[model samples]
Target: MSRFFVNVYSIWAAFWFVFTFLLIFPFQFIFLQKEAWKPMAHRCNRVWAHLFFPLVGMPIRVRYEAGKPDPNQAYVFAANHFSYLDVASMMLIVDTYFAFLGKDVLKKAPLFGYMFSKLHIQVDRNDPKSRSKSLQRSYRALESGRSMVIYPEGGIRTSNPPQMHPSFKDGAFRMAIREQVPLIPISLLNNYQLLPDKKNMRLYPGSVKAVIHKPIETKGMTEADVENLRQQVFDIIQKTLDEYTANPKAHQNEFKRLTVI
Candidate 1:
């Protein structure tokens, strides 16, 4: 818990992360062009996250409140983004043939950036042309039977740390509505504590707890229902966060909920 310990851990984490990247990314990059999407789409992400968690000393546990996601089905997952570690945490949940609808800027990040540019849907939000291309790419990914993960908040909207952003953007919901994919809202309860968005970085060894909520159906949803569906997903994720924050111990165990929204 000391600053010195956290500093020491960060140094170790950086070395291990780069080491793991060197070990895994080359094959992932090669397969992105050479193999089918399902075979290579999430291979590096899953492997990198599995390696990153231990080096950072965080045991990220994914609890299925509804049940384990169906590998055979595709989904549009919208999760709360509150920390630098959120995306890494997300990689743990997306176990099936999956790709992320992530920011275009992420593709510039060193070795992993090449994977982002090639395998995932990268959106430059400021450019209308880029957004259109990204949307089309997302639709194609979904239609091809590969699941996709999207942060509906549009890249860390809440500047004041861990609270849910005031409102959700509709690109992710709109994609689900138009493409008719099931929407799953993910609750990343403690990712912020692991790595906050602050000037002074404090990386530490901690548990990354998360909830895999039931997939909210968007089968009959239209453009008009985007707000309603977005609100519903936001509420589901926010409420779980509130519960976990109020009594961390009460919600530690893996949960199972029979209800589907």
Candidate 2:
């Protein structure tokens, strides 16, 4: 199919899927029912992927590393932020129940805002109150056996080999220490290929990979240990991504579909 037809189908599928989800699932209290929400949300991602990408012809290759951590254990999932699709990649790859620590502005988006508000940890980035509230939500999600996926870099990058900004904030690591959950650093490769940060966007089908680096045990670590753990994950993701840049085929299997253009 032509790119035009694929883009058209992507939009239609997204609209119909979100509309159908809302028609059946109530808008309110989506977070309250974590048990049902986790699996349902993952299924939503798969459905959307199959609908717009595979069916529409923008093949999505999602390469996930083998040996995922057990779902029974709650974890603090930290990932690099690139595209909106990162959330879906995480859900479809990671089997555990989790919620997102996303921007406060997402709560105001048209269709996704309401849904995102469900398990969403909206952060103001500037306001102390919003940060406090987001931290509280993160703590609660961890306590409830749901892992929290937080993007420590804050937002998307302006260039390739995106600088990670700085060491991660103490919030996620601190919570992991207090809650005694392991910190899992996840990396999403080529998610930006599907939806680049450029304006006037249309979703393209491509391979997306999420690398689940071995867990950094925060069991006995203190708040001061956050930076060290942060670097460990940063190094692993950075190094692996650099390697992928040299040889894209090494991680090609992550893409469930191949024909992106």
Candidate 3:
């Protein structure tokens, strides 16, 4: 059944890809040239996620508790990276546009790479120049009323016991402090369940939830504040995942009960 869904979803996704390319691609080019492209890109991402993976029949629903930073305000939105779907899921409720700090290697992918390139600040982790350039671009984006979404844990990790890459990078937090933007630490739970690290394969229908925590204000903060902020964000995500993994049913019911418009 899972394999069946994967096949069906794959075909539908192909059709949708071609359709979007034929219809929306030109507009995407236009939007890319605009100053307000970030939010527009995010809105497009949400629609693509819903329509692209049809085999994953489960709908993508995002519920969030409002934070201190207004959706209108720019932020450095950081989260743990788990799967490729993370980008799509993040775009659902985040009204503003955000630029992701992605590895340069992903730019080589075919059609998907084009979309990623438009929205990402490509960084060659091994090169100092690439890292410096990405930071500069991110700051400019923030100044332009756009947010930067970073996966502080570095790369995707898929395991029963999820472990963050040792020592979260301080670049993002440092930028937030310098720019005086709020640091929004998002916790994504069960996204990996929907689409685990399947090499050369796809996944079946399953729910993906991204819980957004309150933004951590960086007003008057400095480089000294980065570690504390990083640890706090890490703890929140770790604790949330621990709870969900322990009793998914209980947590899901509780989450639904608490979720109100």
Give the Cα lDDT of each candidate.
0.80, 0.68, 0.71
lDDT of 3 at 144: 84
TM-score of each: 0.93, 0.79, 0.84
* Residue 61 displacement (Å), model 1: 1.0
Q: How large an RMSD does model 2 have? A: 4.1
User: Considering TM-score, where higher is better, how would the candidates rank from best to worst?
Assistant: 1, 3, 2
- On TM-score, the candidate that comes out on top is 1
Residue 129 of candidate 1: its Cα lDDT?
100
Q: Write one digit per residue (lDDT tens) for candidate 1, span 1-261.
A: 788888988788778878887888777877887546436657667877777776666676778877888999988888999887887767776678777888889989987888778777898899999999988988988898888888888988887655788788888899888989898889888878878777887777777778888888889889999989988998898888888888988755564322120
Which portions of model 2 show Cα errors greater than 4 Å?
Answer: 1-53, 57-66, 161-163, 251-261
Best by lDDT: 1
Can you give the lDDT of residue 94 in candidate 1? 64
Flag the better candidate by TM-score, 1 or 2. 1
For residue 27, what is the lDDT in candidate 1? 72
What is candidate 2's lDDT per residue for 196-232, written digit by digit as tens? Answer: 6667666665455666777877878877887777777
